[model samples]
Target chain A: MTYCVAMNLAEGLVFVSDSRTNAGVDNIATFRKLHIFGTPGERLVVLQTAGNLATSQSVISLLRQRLDGEEANLHNVDSLFEAARLVGSTLQEVVEHDCGNVQRQGVDLGCSVLLGGQIGEEQPRLFNIYPQGNFIEATRDTPYFQIGESKYGKPILDRALNHATPLEQALRCALISFDSTIRSNLSVGMPLDLLVYHAGSLEVPQGFRVKEGDAYFEGIRAQWCSGLRQLLGELPAPPGDYWS
Target chain B: MTYCVAMNLAEGLVFVSDSRTNAGVDNIATFRKLHIFGTPGERLVVLQTAGNLATSQSVISLLRQRLDGEEANLHNVDSLFEAARLVGSTLQEVVEHDCGNVQRQGVDLGCSVLLGGQIGEEQPRLFNIYPQGNFIEATRDTPYFQIGESKYGKPILDRALNHATPLEQALRCALISFDSTIRSNLSVGMPLDLLVYHAGSLEVPQGFRVKEGDAYFEGIRAQWCSGLRQLLGELPAPPGDYWS
Candidate 1:
């Protein structure tokens, strides 16, 4: 199980992902799910992946392998949309090559990714690419996409985020979503990778590789827990009829 | 599809369930999933059903049928444990009687239940009964159980609930869980059945069948949404490194 979320906000793009991967309870390991590909002022491409570890890593390797060729790399793509297509086709190629054998052993070949970043002066964009090699781009109306262990964290995003949210607030929203997910689910553990890209400033975007005991993440978790308890305590109990 | 949650708390027990049923999105309809079966003073048994509507209805019918005969029924079960076992076996009987026929038409025979309440002098109890007829009681460490479309709502319960939570707080927590679920999942909807049983009382429990326009539920939903948004606003953004 894994969790990766990316938001295409009005100001920029925010990407957050957990680093835990497991074949089974006893086979747990940490593997970074967020991959960054960039060429400074020309383009910034980020991939946050979830589902089968092997399939995603294979897809990433193919994407990286293509970087050496002049025709097909993030550095040379005309737009984020084309970059998304390249990533999707690469994923499809990898799955087609490995799925048959993997499925024979009863392991699902599932993998999906949230691909987002800026290309020159164009607005930052995000896309969710499915394992089948098809994809959906986030629209202003629905400015974020999540992959894996999504439901437990979705409600917070449904309430707190919008296309017009400030970049800082969007980061807060994504971490709150992550906090909720990690608290409820054991499979998604700490050491989070986060990237905040300012719309046009394509330089290595400001971000953090947050770990357990990190002051900022720890503060947010503690405050959110007690804050929620306090908020619920403040609400009026259901009316008399609701109880009796 | 349905969403049902039941909690065993120190003050008593709480059960809440949505009333949606669908063969497909276009074939959706409403059906109450909460059922009550017991003699008021001697016992107070509540059953919340989920999964295949037909299988659950059949299981419910068998339980009701036993009430008119000489064999043991909810009214005669020695403890809530006995009541859960009875419910489980009756469910198994219903599945055995109908599964093969149902599966021939390409429908799953799935059905599960949350069984909770008190019997005679026994303490309040809750059990999650599986389709296979095996059931497990909620322990102090994990005092609640949810069935059907459970993931979206699970985080709230995981964060806010405990075995010793007061009855009123438990109701609030369950409602919050339901609100999150209903917002994220279309299959779980309004017109909910809620029952709160005070431990050791064994009398008629207090509860309501809440509908879409119910004032108390509306208030809880409104307060929670804004409360969450406000809470996120107050939390410090990830350190300067996170946003730069």
Candidate 2:
């Protein structure tokens, strides 16, 4: 399992993803799920994936392999929408290639992807690409997309994030969301990959890789936990009459 | 879908459940999921259910119907453990009776139950009964059980709840959990049914049914939302160096 969240905010785009994947409890391993594509200062496209590891890896390899070919790829795509379509189609191609043999063994070959970044002069956009070669772009009303192990971390995003949120604040909220998910679910673990893309930069910014005991991540976790407990304690308890 | 949570805390037991049930988005309706049983001053038991509404309703109806029969019933159970077994078996019976026909149409007939209360001189106990007629009791290390639409509301409970948490605080936490679920999931909604039992009382206490305009519940919602926003703001944002 994986948890990847990306937000297309007013100031920029924020992406956070956990690095753990497991075939089973005993077969746990770390796999990087965040992939950066496109040419620096020309087009910046980020892809975060979840679901079947084999399918995602294959899709990523195919996307990278096609970059030097004549066919459209993440690098040469005219817009984020076209880039999303290419990713979606590549995912579909990979699944279809392995799905027949995989389905006979009752294994799922589906994968979900979050594609977000700037392409040339267009504004930053985010898209959630499903396994069936289809996608939906994020809009102002719903400016974020999350894939895999999403529910445990969704409440904070629902409560705190919006299109107009500053890039830094959105990054913080995304980290807290990951913290909540990692606490409740063992399938999702650190080290985490975080990227904050300033709109129109068309260049990947300096991303942070939060490993175990990383001071900033640790501080945020401690502060968030203690702060939540404090907030709950301060909230008025139900009236005595309501109990009786 | 439904959201019901029960906690066995030091002070006593707390149960909170949403009332909405839906066959589909267009078929939404209200049905109480909380049921009170056992004789006052002798034994007190409460059941909160989620899953197929028909199956839960049938299980509840059968439990009530058997109360007057010679067979053992909730009112006649020797202990809360016995009561949990009885509920579990009754649920299994209901599901088995309808499963063959219902499953032929590809509909699910499973339901989950949370049973908690006291009997005679024994301490209060909580049980999470599965559809297979098996159950697990809550322990000091894990004193709560949530059924249906649980993930969206789980982080706060994981952060703030413990066996040592006071009954009032546990109740408050349960309500907030329900609020989070309702906000994120369309399947779970109000009005909510809440019951708080004081340990050793051995009698059913007055339970609160919170409706849409209920002032206390509205206050909690307002306070929790604003308080969470304030808390997020006060927490330091990730350092600028992380983003570059």
Clashing pairs in 1: none
DockQ for model 1?
A: 0.71
Stretches of model 1 off by over 4 angstroms after superposition: none
Give per-residue CA lDDT, model 1, range B128-201, as digits (tens): 99989999999999999999999888888888899999989889989989999999888889999999888988
lDDT of 2 by residue, A10-88 (tens): 8889999999999888899999999988688898899999999999999999999889989898888899999988998
- What TM-score, to 2 decimals, does candidate 1 have? 0.97
In candidate 1, the second chain superimposes onto the true chain B with a TM-score of 0.96
Shift of residue A244 alpha carbon in model 1, Å: 3.2
Give the Å shift of residue B223 in candidate 1: 1.2
